[model samples]
Target: MRVLVYGSGQLAQMMYLAAAPLGVIVSAVDVSNETVVHPVSKEPTGVSLQNAIEDANAITVEFEHVPEHLLLDADKSGKLFPNVASILAGADRVREKALLSKHEIPNCPYLIITDVTDLDNVIASLGERVIFKASRDGYDGYGQWRMQSADQLEKLKSEFAKLDLVKVPLIAERMMQFDREISLVGARDSEGNVSCFSLAENLHFEGQLHVSVAPITDLSDSLQSQANEIFEKLATAMDYVGVLAVELFQCGEELLVNEIAPRVHNSGHWTQQGCDTSQFEQHIRAVLGLPLGAVDVRGVSAMVNIIGCTAFSRDLIGIAGAHLHWYGKEVRTKRKMGHINVVADSHSHLGNKLAQLLAFLPVEHFPELEAEANRLKNYTK
Candidate 1:
């Protein structure tokens, strides 16, 4: 079997690696140039876009932001998994909010803004603190602004007034007092069968994910069930088939939907070493009608993203169950260079592994590592 993925990034590379052992070939498209490229080496494959589409057994995206014209062309092949509408819902906040509201899925209270005058009532409707996000092409802290006080409204409005709001609107979300951010990554087969990995607790710095610990300490059956129900509602509603990730904010026992990713997600990277089947493989299975793999975890796991800095000691892998996956990209500030996944028998052990792994890393690039290690070091349940 062969699959074609729409974005030639790390996710596509991972998918290619995972599919190899399954007797499947995965190729990627560079959306910018419409050329098919090798998923790992990223060299041009010299294959035409139309020919690649014809050759693929299935077509999917590594990210939601693929060009609409390209997505429409892929959809015409009748091989696009999760479909064009689902991808669009993920790419645009307006469509995403509408999808949630249409299905009665709980999400952050938000208002759409197409004009600067809309800011006048934001403080009245949502409150003083609001997070404004671009309706499209925003991720990892870009295209976002936060308003902390009523006095800052004019300055924000002035900045926003310079943009073409009608073409790319803003979504003003009322900030919620949530305890921690968590995500559910799951796959739904064409037959509607669903399998979900354990909920992962995520830590972010400057809006980029820094660390994620899976099977969060003190995980409750009720909490897992609630997350599953939310997943079921959204997946079934969209007729989604492939790996889907839902990021949630936990306000005590309630889970409020923050955002959804229509493709494999960064937060799910832990599954590569922690679970019976990696998310990349599971996504391939789902899109190709293969039976879903077990979601059972091997042990407690922590996935630490290696952001921006590449000078870390490679010997960190000497620690048992420590594995590194590098993206082989040129380093840029706040860019995800690679990730390290560590699995241990228990949370405390996992924390110790992370703490040990810290010695090899430069603390400046990983600001949250120490605190997260300390938090998990004494966790009991």
Candidate 2:
């Protein structure tokens, strides 16, 4: 079997790695150049994008920011997994909100802002604090602004005046103060067989994911059931046939959908070392119409993103249970260089190993991380 994945990034790299053992040939397309490349070798042997897609048994995406024309063409080929409609929903926040509302899936109350004039009413209704997001092409915290008060709103208007809100529009969501954030990465087969992984606790710094812990400690049964139900509703609604990620905000006992990722997600990266079936393999299986694998947790796991800096010590490998994944991208400010996954028999043990691993990281970039690690160690003990 062969799979053609859109976007040549780390997710595509991981998917390619997972498919190898299954005897699946995974190839990637560079959306910018429209060149077909081998995902593992990163070799550009010069195959036309159309030929690559035509030869694949299935097509999927590593990210949502695929070119519309390419997606349309793939749709016409009848090979796009999760389908164009689902991909479009992920690309635009307006479409995402509408899909959630249509399915009665609980999410933050939001307004579609066609112009700056609409901001006034949205603020009055949702309150002083609101999160303004571009309806399209926004991810990893870009194209987002937080309005804490009327003054901030005025500043944002002036700062973003060059943007034609009327043309692309924006999504204004009520800034929610949630107790914690959790995510569910689940897969749905063509026959609608859905299997969900354990809930993952995520921590974000400046809109980028910093860390994730699997089987969020003290997660209540009611909340788990609610998250599962939400995923099922969305998968069935979209007729989804691949891995989908649902990010949730746990406010008290209630969970509200924060957003949906139509492909395998970053937060689910811990599953690489922690689950019976890694999310990459699960996604490939689902899209290929194979039976979904077990979502069983193998152990307590923590995944820490290696962002921006590339000066970490190679000695980090000496730490027990530490696994590193480097993206082989040119290092730049705030770029996600790689990630480290640490697994243990229990969360307490995992926390300690994380502390040991942190020692090998640059102290300048993660000043408070050492302190936070100490606190976690004490708490776990």
Candidate 3:
């Protein structure tokens, strides 16, 4: 079987790797040039976009920011899996909020702001400390501004005056002081069958994911059930037919939806080594209308993102339970260069191994962090 994937970043690369073993041919479109490139071989070929879609048995996306024209064209071809409606919901925060509300899925209270005038009422209603996000094309910390006080709002108004807020609009969300953030990566088949991986705890730095631990430590069965129910509700609402990731905020015993990712997600990267079926393969299977793979956890796992700086000792391989997957990308500030997965028989064992592995990472890249992490790891054990 052949599949066409939108976007040519690391997620596409990983999908290429996973599809290879299944004898599935995956090709990627640059989205900029509309150029077709073989996923595994990374060889550029001269196939037109129409022909590429015609030849492929299925189409999927690595990310949601695909151009609407291209998505519309693919929809006409009847090859787009998970559909344009689902993709749009993932791309726009307004649409996302509407979907959640329509399904009665719990999420942070939010308002759509088209004018600076609307901000005053929203602030008065929701209070101070709101997160302002661009409704479209925002990811990895860009296209967002935080308002902590009335002064910040005044400044933001000045900033928005320079840009066209009406055309793009923004989502203003009430800031919740949550105890932790967790995510569920689940797959749905055409028949509406769904399977979810264990909930994962995520740690973010400056709006970028830094680390993820799967089968979150001390996660209760009730919490897991709540997360699973939310995922199922979302999948059914969207008529989704592929891997979907739901990020959640846990406050006390309650969980609220933070956002939804229509494709495989960074939080699921630990599943590469920790699950019976990696998310990439499962997504491919779901899109191709194949039976979904098992979502069983193989062991407790931690995935640490290698952002930006490339210089690191190869001796990191010597650290027990360490496995590295590096994306061949030009080094730039804050780029996701690669990731390392560390696994152990139990969460405590995994925590200790991760602490040891952190010591081997260069101090320049991550400073004074290892000591605190080590202290916590030991204390928890």
Candidate 4:
């Protein structure tokens, strides 16, 4: 089987690695230049976009932000998995909010802001503590602003006025004091069969995911059930095919939807070492109409992201059950360099492994590792 993926990034590269073992060939389109390239090495394949689209048995994407023109071309092939509407919902918050509202899914209270004066009513509607996000093309803390009190509204409106809100708009969300953030990663095959990995508790710093722990300690049956129900509703509504990731904010016993990722997600990266079948492999299986694999977890697992700094020792993999995945990209501030997946029989063991990993990683870049390690080291249940 041959699959062509849009947006040649780490996700596509991981998919290529996973697909190869299944006897599937994966090629990636460098959306920036529209040239087909080898997924890993990124060398040009000399295949035109049209030829690549026509040759592939399946078409998919590593990310949702592929240009509209490219997506339209792929859609015309009748091979694009998950469809264009699903991808657009993942890319634009305006469409995403509408989808959630239409489906009656619980999410943060929000107001759409298309004009500067929209801010004047935000406090009355959603309260003073809120986050403003670009309705399109915003992620990793970019194109976002926070207001803790009504006093900040005038200054915020001035900052927002400089931009053309009419073009992109803004989504003002009421911030909730959630207990923690978690995500469900699952696959829906063409036959409508679904399989979901264990929920992963995510930790983020400055809007970038820094670490994810799967089969989180203290997990409850009700919590997992809630997540599964949410997944089924959204996936079925879209008739989605391929892996879909649903991000949630856990407040007490209830899980409110935070966002939906229409492709393989950063939080699910723990599946590489933690689950019976990695999410990358499941995604490939779904898009190709192959039988879905088991989502059973092997043990406690933690995925620590390597962000920005590359000066750390690479020998951390020497720790038992520790695996490193480097993206082979040039380092820059806040850029995701790679990730480390560590699995253990118990939470304490996982914490010990992470503690050992810390010695090889610089402290400044990984502010949460030590704290997270300690918390897990003493964790119960």
Q: What is the TM-score of each candidate against the true structure?
A: 0.99, 0.96, 0.96, 0.99
* TM-score of candidate 1 against the unseen true structure: 0.99
lDDT of 3 by residue, 242-304 (tens): 999999999988999999999999999999999999999999999999999988898788888
Ten residues in a row with the worst lDDT in model 2?
A: 367-376
The candidate that achieves the highest lDDT relative to the unseen native structure: 1
Better of 3 and 4 by TM-score: 4
lDDT of 2 by residue, 1-381 (tens): 999999899999999999989999889998888888888667885878888888889999999989989999988879899899999999999999999999999899999988777777877788888999999988989999899887787777776677888877898899999988899999999999999999998888888888888888776888888899999999999999999999999998888999999999999999998999999999999989889999889888888888899999978988888899999999998898898888888777777887898779986655445554554566553
Residue pairs in steric clash, candidate 4? Answer: none
Error of 2 at 22 (Å): 0.4
- CA deviation > 4 Å runs, candidate 2: 379-381
* Alpha-carbon deviation at 38 in model 2, angstroms: 1.1
* Clashes per candidate, residues 3 or more apart or on different chains: 0, 0, 0, 0
What is the C-alpha lDDT profile of model 1 across 1-381, one tens digit per residue? 999999999999999999999999999999999999999999999999899999999999999999999999999999999899999999999999999999999999999999999988899999999999999998888999998888899999999999999999999999999999999999999999999899999999999999999997779999999999999899999999999999999999999999999999999999999999999999999999999999999999999999999999999999999999999999999999999999999999888998999899998999999999988988866
True-vs-predicted CA distance for residue 192, candidate 3, Å: 0.1
lDDT of each: 0.95, 0.88, 0.88, 0.94
Clashes of 3: 0
Query: Sorted on lDDT, highest at the top, how do the candidates line up?
Result: 1, 4, 2, 3
Query: Residue 312 in candidate 2 has what lDDT?
Result: 95
Off by over 4 Å in 1: none
